[model samples]
Target: MAFRNGTDSWVVVMFFMIVVILFPLGVGPEPDILNKISSGVIWVAALLSAMLSMDRLFHVDYDDGSLELLVLHPQPLEFIVLAKVLAHWLTTGLPLIIVSPLLAIFLNMDISSYFVLIITLFLGTPTLSLIGSIGAALILGARRSGALLSLIILPLFIPVLIFGVSAVEASILGVSSKPQLLILGGLFLLSSALCPIASAASLRQAIE
Candidate 1:
């Protein structure tokens, strides 16, 4: 599932490139300025791309009635939701992290920030997926679910965005990026604890 969704979602790579390239092009060609701004722009683009891809997380299975069957499975819905979330991370989140370094280069970021960017994305994107699943579950089967999902999700995403971009910013300045990553890790852990149950509840409500 992860492989399938990831391959299907590869167009997001194009979006990422456009964001990384066009911003500097529109602003100026200064590599120093580009590096300074690159991490935030790339991460933001990745976040939006992931959000765009998230609607398909359940929509495909739901449309095919597989979601209904999964609901009836012996294992708990929480586990099922976790699986889906993991698949979402593997497909959408991991690839973004993998490509972040090249994007970071284009942005003119220092090499040291490379570790920070990857770690931040690793800690952060899971929280995005978990939160996105909540929105996905909430709007399942509803009209304009794509737009509604973003409306429900974008607000919840602000903290992750702030901390994630901050971590990169800190890295660029040669300051310890640990605190920001720690906060992101804490957010990921909290979301991991609560998001599956929340998603399951939302799924129940939507299906009912």
Candidate 2:
């Protein structure tokens, strides 16, 4: 299903790149200034990019009635929600990670921080998807659900964003990023364990 919506994925990737590109243009082309803000800029763009496609996570299935079938399946709805979240991460989050190196270069991020940026993104983006899933499910059938989904999920995304940027910033400053990375990992595990179940419950409520 995600593959079928390839255009959305492309739009997200383009948006991520464009946002990063805009910072250089808007903030002036000074490499020093860009370097200072690179981690935050990239992370913010990734967060918004992730949110861009979030509404589609379950909306298509819900609209087409596949969500109802999946909910009614003998298999646990949580597993179904988890699978969809994984697909969402693959389509949306994975692209951000893949394209981030070039964006990092564009932002004048230090070479040493590149690895930490990738690591943080890898750890953080799935958590974004998982947590976003709950909001996506909650906003099902809602009018202007895209805005509502943003409102519901943006606060939840802040922790991931903070730690993700902090990890990269630490590396740039020649400090250890392990603490932030560990926290990001913990967030991923926590969201992985909890978000699916929460999303599944919301999905049930939505369908009713």
Candidate 3:
């Protein structure tokens, strides 16, 4: 409803681009190094972008009192939480994925690695949205929720980061990125199943 008014979609896209722009300036414009680090940098920037926007996922609903209604509604809160997560990914992750190819080209990332880069994001960003739901829920009305949300969720994001970067690196090396891809897929599945339930429980506690 607030797509026109809300800045998150624009912010995330601009945030990802800004981060990508800064890396070469910070690291020097050496082609070899840029090419080598591009995948990792892209993944890192994308991760932080997702994290940056996560607070908006539930904080808005909580502030507006809609979250409590969903929590107390007849339908299970878990399912509602899942729907929110899905919507979050659709809005945030999808744009990031769509713009990533341009970032890859700008970073001098090899064309061969583009396939892996896109695949990893397709599998990994949704996992970010799923996992972030828990952190967002836990701090719905807490003091300094954004800072606390970062601390709580950054550690949890490491494995996804690892597998995601690894997949790109593997593809760059001309090796099969299948193993890392599979791990990310598994992590997404695990998070998709658990995070909504966990977030729902937290929301229920918060509302009660």
Candidate 4:
């Protein structure tokens, strides 16, 4: 289903690129300035990009009654929710990581920081998708869910963003980013354990 919606996937990637592109234009092309803010800018763009496609995470399933069927399935609904979240990350978060090196260049970030940036993103983006699944499920049938979903998830995303950018910045400063990366890893593990169950419960409620 995620692959079938190629346009939506591309939209997420485009939104991410545009956000990164705009920062260089708005902040001027000064390499030093761009370099300094690069980590934050890219991380923020990624967060927003992840948020962009979240509304549709289970909207289609809900509309077509697939959600009810999944909830009624013999297998656990949490596993089903986990699968959906995995699909969402593949179509959304993976693209951001793939294209981030080019954006880092646009922001004049150091080559040395690229690996750490990618590492942080690898650890952080899935957590975004995982945590986002809960919000997406919560707003399953709510009006103006896009806005409401953002409200529900944005605060939750802050910690991931903070740790992600901090890891990149630490790498750029020649400091070990291990601590931040470890924290990101922990966040990912925590979200992975919790979000699918929460999403499954919300989906059950929404379909009730």
What is the lDDT for 47 in model 3?
91
Global lDDT scores for all candidate models: 0.84, 0.92, 0.89, 0.92
Q: After superposition, how far is residue 161 of candidate 3 from its true place, in Å?
A: 0.3
Q: Report the lDDT tens digits of candidate 1 across residue range 90-132.
A: 8778777788777777777777888888888889999999989
lDDT by residue for model 2 over 15-118, one digit each (tens)?
Answer: 99999999999999999999999999999999999999999888888899998899899999999888889899898899889998899889887778999999
Q: Give me the displacement of residue 175 in model 4, in angstroms.
A: 0.8
Give RMSD to native, each candidate: 1.5, 0.9, 1.3, 0.9
Clashing pairs in 4: none
Once all C-alphas are superposed, what RMSD does model 2 give against the true structure? 0.9
Q: What lDDT score is found at residue 124 in candidate 2?
A: 92
Compared with the true structure, what per-residue lDDT tens digits does model 3 show for residues 93-182? 899999998888888988879989999999999999999999998987799988999999999999999999999999888999999999
Name the runs in model 3 displaced over 4 angstroms. 1-6
The parts of candidate 1 lying over 4 Å away from their true place are: 1-6
lDDT of 4: 0.92
